[model samples]
Target: MSDIATAAGGFRYRLWRGLDPLPSGLPTGFAALDALLPSAGWPAGSVIEVITPAWGIGELRLFLPLMQRLSQQDQYAVWIAPPYTPYAPALTQAGVSVAGVVIVQPPQPQQTLWSMERLLRTGACGLAMAWPRQPTPRTTRRLQLAAQSGHSLGVLFRRQHAGPCRHTLPVALSLRLDAAENGLAIEVLKARGGGQLPAVTLVWP
Candidate 1:
């Protein structure tokens, strides 16, 4: 069940099975950033944390490539509790399969986490993304375990806060995104088998 991704000029990337030490991951649609990751892309079956100072800073753009690939797959790409309604036309223009994209908004914040865990643990979805407010370490750990169980990718987007402590979270990867002069700057805060690396700048996807 290898997930295959083909890039421009016939380049291909292969996703490996989930393992304890991590394995080759799915392409993130950006070659420069992929070169910086140990798995060469987003680690499959693991949770990733994206921390930003504010919204609309190209945070969603970073995952657009990955979303496009996952959405078109046999499984669904579920988005839980998005900040705003996703614009279909814009997503279509980005090469995403609208039919494969599903949105779920829970009335209560706690329910959002529960929904994300269920979807990720079902093995029926390729990816599950959420924007949870005040996620405790226990909550993240649960999400991580669920992703591992289903071999799905889980993304948690959080706003930058004062005195932020990323060490408390059990996510497999933690990245800090900031707006660069020409494009977006992705700083690798924490990664499996690696420490903080230099930021990689690339045009918005």
Candidate 2:
């Protein structure tokens, strides 16, 4: 005998449900983009892996809105081994409360991962971002678990072509980004409906 578990009301799919009712996503500050996402925004308490060809590239802009909101809520926003110095003026322009933001530049990539895990697992921070050199399958899984354990948001940034391994990682979401003249071109490699989603264009205001 099997229990019938379903989500999205009528649509039924054999999927493992989480311990709690699915939490709502944080608004991504873009209406069109949010509508495209299954969760309507960034999935909370899960690891989101983003692959980009280069650093900057408006990638920080993509999350700045969310970070601003998190800061407004008085939640800790931590950055691990950021590729560039996070300018205070830029953060202020983005509306992120500079006070609530913490940047940790560990001497080693391993230490960066360790720091992210602790912040996520302890719920000490509402959001954590890390730039990993090359995360192993075991490492990715550990980060995922740590975020889910405390209902925190974890974002792992990596360079493009650093993938192929992305398909094997246990992240809740995976997005490949290319810098566009005006914004970003995102390919949803993996998301709610499973692998194989079309690309979308995101323009910043």
Off by over 4 Å in 2: 1-23, 162-167, 193-195
Model 1 lDDT tens row, 16-132: 325356645889989998887867889998899999999888888888888888767757889999999989999999988888899999999889999999999998888898999
Against the hidden true structure, what lDDT does model 1 obtain? 0.84
RMSD in angstroms, all models? 6.4, 4.4
TM-scores of all models? Answer: 0.86, 0.86
| CA lDDT for candidate 2 | 0.81
Alpha-carbon shift of residue 159 in model 1 (angstroms): 0.2
Flag clash pairs in model 1. none
lDDT of each: 0.84, 0.81
- Please identify model 1 stretches exceeding 4 Å from their true place: 1-19, 164-167
